[model samples]
Target: MLSSLALLSVVLPSALAATTYDMVKEYSGSTFFNDWNFYGQFDNLTNGDAIFVTSSVASSSKLAYVDSTTNRAIIKVDNTSTVAFNDKRNTVRISSKDEFDIGSVWIADMYHVPFGCSVWPAFWSQAPNWPSGGEIDTFEHWNLELHNQMTLHTEPGCTQASPVQTATVVNSTDCSFQDNSNAGCGVMDSTDSSYGAKFAAAQGGVFVTEMAESGISVWFFPRSSVPASLSSNASSFSTADLGTPTANWPTAGCAIDTYFKAQNLIFDITLCGDAAGAASVFQQTCSGVCYTDYVVGNGSVYDNAYFDVASVRVYSVTGMNTIVRVSSALGFRAGCWVWGAAALSGAVVLFAL
Candidate 1:
């Protein structure tokens, strides 16, 4: 009885703490498109250069489909149809059927992204209620520009000053919408190789976004530089184990939990409206031609306008187990994993019986 009572003291607390991450959800494979809700019609990005942009998106069209060759979801902007002076170009905008809350990790594996003149492609997530719910842009680029940008847009009073990563450029540390730059609290890759043609030349890569108590982090892993743990093809993994991220937005001066909440994942393509055509944008890519004219008239230029995605895996924070070390008289402490308190108590009672 004495020995058993001593064991109970140590084992009870440890059992309640030993936990592990479980794969709560997975959206993988070509058929994965079936699980997503496609937004046909026009793009919802009504601000910026996109205000002038319209959509010819259709539900059963090639603008969004599953490719047979690579078994990846192929989302594209239409360059196949005839375009007039004022016609909306064909494009695709889709989103996940599900929504994710805070403290989740999102992994998107892609093969190609729609790129080039007057084009804008983005993979992002946003909550239902504007800036109050927070926004995360995992992939965004425009025109002939050769860099990838990851931005976070949130309500007022949120500013991040996390340690900068190697070669990462911080465009703004404040995510509030009041900033004139609209750069948001974001970061950009130093080299052009991480986006557009150069990124395609290297066969695409993985973009991972992890949202936890520490704030938000975005990491880009070129196909050649992917980690072994992620390459193993598991349904879920801990973001804490991913080491240093390419972009880290720690909640040092702000409470990220207060500003951000459930968000719907979205993928969209728009042409010559906000960012590309704005008077302030780097519009030199169009040369003497008008941005809209080139985008609408030059139908053949968008032949390669598309996003090829292999899969998007989502993981919840419940995966991280709380490890409480316990040393019994027998000194059994090495890798002895148990469970919650209620389960352990019941087991001890049965053992006594």
Candidate 2:
């Protein structure tokens, strides 16, 4: 009787504590962008709650445009010229006016970012560099995917490879790399589709990042399976509501909490050659070229580089636990080892019965 009771206790709690998350926000039309704050100076465009542009020439270039079907805004990039790093030349800033206290877990529904030769598009964050403020690149595709990278640019040692602590995904050799300590850390989702287009598909998906007192976890969910409530705030969801866990949680060598806990969010779409050290990759002949010539020749290549954000929401865990529960039910079945163990344990019980 005692043994049976103990077994019931374990199994019941495990079943009741199923992993679930809430849907904080969702967007599905051209009207969503109306309330966002837009920055950067370019002319010749349409302005409304639906579309925005810096220059009509830039807009026509294809690097910047809007999509009505997927209801996504794209930021395309062309390697022909170096517009990414120029602080003054090309920049687009879009952020939410509402400032919510971001807890450890958050997600972004982004459609795509640039991934061509010599192109750089980043979905990152920043705070004043005081107690040493820094940057976290959630999705960074640089130099033709040779080294799809994510890093923390902070007081030395705060990079992706040197996370202060470590964590791992279940049953896999794949690992998350925290290149620097204070700078930032990230994992690579090496699917063939770019981050932007993947989120914008008809099945629009979810990009989730959870920063717990214990660590951080990030995962993506396709639109078809995403909960309807999470698709829009028409209803509210708590973490406890996320039915079963998905095996996609980060379970490798770096601590997710170390990089994502208690941070503010920033959304900006920058042209090529804007960051500090991204110019050398440009073709030699393309140097000293003006935006007009580049657009005329092959410049308009990046014209569609845009990030359509359906919604951004933050959640608080309110506890200090280190282990993040992930479910293998979504395509990721429990491995052979776990199944074998369960069978052996059950056999032992049957003999006793």
- Deviation from native of the Cα of residue 51 in model 1, angstroms: 11
Query: Best-fitting candidate, measured by TM-score?
Result: 1
lDDT of 2 by residue, 133-181 (tens): 3334455553244222333433333322222211121111112222211
Q: Candidate 1's error at 167, in angstroms?
A: 4.3
Residues 1-353, candidate 1: write the lDDT tens digits.
11111121111111111112445556666566665554443434432222212223343556676778877877787676656665567676666656677667778888888887777788887765666777888888777767777778777887766443543445556677655234466566555666788888888988888766667778888888877767776755555445566776667755778878776777877776556544334344455443555555657888767888888777776744222122122221111111111122221110000
Best by lDDT: 1
- Where does candidate 1 have its weakest 10-residue lDDT segment? 9-18
What's the count of clashing pairs in each model shown? 8, 72
The positional error of residue 139 in candidate 2, measured at the CA in angstroms, is: 2.0
Shift of residue 278 alpha carbon in model 2, Å: 3.8
The lDDT of model 1 is 0.61
Sequence-dependent TM-score of model 1: 0.78
